[model samples]
Target: MRFYRQFRAYLVRRKVWEVTAYLFFGILTTLVNVLIFSVAFRLLELPWPTSNSLSWLVSVIFAFFTNKLWVFHSGASGTRSTLWTLLKFMLVRILSYGLDMLTMWLIIDAMHGNELIAKLITQVLVVAVNYIFSKLFVFADSNSG
Candidate 1:
């Protein structure tokens, strides 16, 4: 029990806790994206692009709230501040979404590769990039400025 408490305390250290929380939320976000995309693309016969966009929308919304509240602990300060933060988050995500679309297009459309495989690859890339952006830009401490 003592060792377990120490381990828990170690995990709760700032960077460690942030990363662990981000990873947990990130995985949930990925699952949300993949499930929506799979259902739309494979089950409903939607085009890959449309399905991907829809999935991105849902997952981004999920990610923003989870990332803000749990991962970074960047709780809303005021309406304007929260809106600004959300705007920045969306802009960064749009950049990553472009990357996602381009990679997916190249793999599934141009290279004639598997859509699901391409999506999985894209998720890994997107998640890494999003973490960087969110940590450095979107959710950085407001008082740091």
Candidate 2:
């Protein structure tokens, strides 16, 4: 109860309900990725990395739609404007993906850290990066100075 009260206070103070919603949708995206990967690799007997790549692709598409419509409520209108915003979103995600790989390599290989711990740290960094890029670049209001 005390923890819940403290969490609620933090949410009210920060007004970061979007972060909460993003996390909710992120979980759904993870589930979708895992389900697709499992079906492709185990049931359909696809190649090892191919299944993973396909799953990631589908999940990214799912995430783009959900984040634009639900999480950030992007105001980009017109086909060109929307496409531009999507391109920015994809670019940011691609950059973050590179960062994730670099972080994992630095932590696990260079620093001799555990793989799971390195991955967790990398994921946290990626989430922060994605949120910042999405808010400032992909979803920023064009009219705002």
For each candidate, what is the lDDT?
A: 0.90, 0.74
- Which stretches of candidate 1 lie above 4 Å from their native place? 1-8, 142-145
Model 1 per-residue lDDT at 36: 94
Error of 2 at 86 (Å): 0.9
Candidate 1 residue-wise lDDT, 1-145, digit = tens: 9996676578875438677778889999999999999999999999999999999999999999998887888855899989999999999999999999999999999999999999999999999999999999999873310
lDDT of 2 at 143: 35
Clashing pairs in 2: none
Candidate 2 lDDT, tens digit per residue, 60-86? Answer: 788889988877877887999889988
Best-fitting candidate, scored by TM-score? 1
Clashes of 1: 0
Every model's TM-score: 0.90, 0.66
